[model samples]
Target: MDAEQAHGPGGPRWWRGRGTPWRSTLLLTVFVFVGSAFAARMQQGERAELDLFARVLLLVACALLLWRRRYPVAVVFGTAVAVALYLGAGYPYGPVFLTVAVACFSAVVAGHRRAAWTALGLLCAVHLLVAYWLYRWLPPSGDAPASLGQELVVAGWVVAIVALAELARSRREQWARERAERAQAARRRADEERLRIARELHDVLAHSLSVINVQAGVGLALLDADPEQARTALTTIKSASKEALGEVRQVLDSLRTPGDAPRTPAPGLDRLPELVEQAARAGLTVEVAGEPPRLSPGTDLAAFRIVQEALTNVVRHSGSRHARVRIDEERGTLRLRIDDDGPATGADAGGGGNGLAGMRERAAALGGTIEAGPRADGGFRVLAVLPVKATAEGGEDQ
Candidate 1:
């Protein structure tokens, strides 16, 4: 590889700061040189006497490791060549092999397995030639040929080192994959949470504000003509505003203490009376048909919101002054349908805003579906079908 590619980002932890292995390589060089000097003294009259040339060869082999983290393939072969020359010159065999092993291990872990193996094979071939045949010509006069058993033992050691490097590489890759998966999961949860909060705020404000808007208009038009009726409209406004603030505060509390139980139970079909009362204040008469079935918490909350958004749409967008809410259950499913009796004025006819979209999302999140449009008769309707048992599979058509 080129120098730029070799020294690129994400090389390895060892090459993290300063992007060099200078200190470690310098220490290894000193250790190998000093250790070899001790081995030369121990060999005494058996091997060639330690000389300036032999020391230089040892330094070259260890120094090549300085680039092992960057140019692993080049460093592996470079160290092998230096060590082969030292052995071919009949220098005493000591800590010199450590340099080649370190270089080979680095090359293998850096995904240059073929280069590391080729360098190792060449070094072994050179050692065989020098020990058995070239000894008569090159080495310190009368050196004997190496035994077959000793060669086998050295070959096994090299194989074990390569295997260990392969294992380490596998583990590093596995850890990287796990970390990526965890990060992706975290982001998915955050997006889901943000969408949920947006839905809650939309439902609470839309319904209450629509009621307050109608009452405020009534109070303005009748302020002087009928003071008692205007006073009643102002009172209705106060009640709607207070209820809206309470629901908003409840939603915010859940955000502040994420895992804790809500201070008040979530609104459900059980609160249908209160919802109807709120709609009455907006001048919409609602009739309830069919009983609400017991459902999972997620299904219950979604059912309530669908009803609320549908009624709010009627108040703000439908010209109808009357609406109908029908609830029923069959085959472990809860079904809700809200209908208004005339032509739509704005968003209820699918013109704009997230009211209809939020209702669809709430149903889909609980493994349900929402259908909304103008009826063949003379009005707009919203129909939602939710599984009584909660699930996160989004939804499927009924």
Candidate 2:
């Protein structure tokens, strides 16, 4: 949807406003000017002539009120002063009184509570003083009614108008607050989607690249040593490359069309042994000690990535010829613990740079946690715990 046509109160019409307060004030000023001018022309001919100066001053004050919303205190004071000066003239009550109401509202809308109160006090004082004077000595020439009750009723109506305007302003503020909250929620969802995309790409690239790298290395070694073994390794490399390409195409197609066919699900605990076998092929004696749990796809994916990274760490850092991995699921958490004996030589090796970091991030995203460090048993250990359902800890039942 267009920005102005977003989901909001007032059918999005409220969003179609000028960019700045100055423009809004200009529009209002032009409107007030035109309205006041029309009202003045309709006055009785003699009255219009006598109060020409009063009409001009009142129109100028009304037009000036465009800026009242921006600088409420200043405009209210200026307009109030002008109205007080013109009240004694033979001017009609409409325009002068309109200016007072606008001043009070503008002050309130500008968020100046103290100034609005001051403006209200000034408005009441000037109106009361003029009303008293008019009552004590009737201006027979003016068009005002003789009834005191009618005067009070008119004053009450003005007060009600100000209250209504304040109510509208508060409602508009509330709508703005709600709109901001919705925008924040949308941003959060977009962030999550981006993270998921990154996870898929990492898994697809890492596993596929590992297989390709191994096969390519084997092929290079057997280029003359054994053409038969070299051809087989080349075949594995071709198959791995083809699968990676297909997965990449599917990911790209899904992005272009949201309703594209779904791809195969990501592997989890069910393929833990297969993962271990793959590690074994790399000359690492990987021992799987416990039955991995059947978990939700998210938790399962986290576990798979955790084990993959842990074994990769063993192959990369631990000079150990053998590595042991154990997975235990209890109390709604699937935990994987992996340890490896030190490598043969004392040569220092760097640990998981992006691999371990990615594992920790995956665990965290699934409402899980991980720990990795050298163990006291002459080996290194990596541990990860993933929550199956909700992240909250379960009941401490005996």
Candidate 2 has which clashing residue pairs, if any? 319-343, 320-342, 320-343
List the global CA lDDT of all models: 0.84, 0.65
lDDT at position 344, candidate 2: 33
Residue-wise lDDT of candidate 1 within 294-332, one digit each (tens)? Answer: 777778788999999999999989899999999999999
lDDT value for model 2: 0.65
Give each model a TM-score. Answer: 0.83, 0.71
**lDDT tens digits by residue: candidate 2, 1-398:** 32213423212234324223556556655665566556556765423333467657766676666666445668778877777666545444454566667666655554554565676677667666665665334332544432578467767866775786578557766777788899998898778667766766766666666666666788999999999989988877787678778766655554665665657666677877777666665557888888866676667767877787777666555678688889788887787898888743442233325777788778777677889888786778888887876343221111
Runs in model 1 with CA error above 4 Å? 1-49, 63-78, 107-137, 142-146, 347-352, 392-398
Q: What's the true lDDT of residue 54 in model 1? A: 92
> Cα miss at 42, model 2 (Å)?
15
> In candidate 2, how many clashes are counted?
3
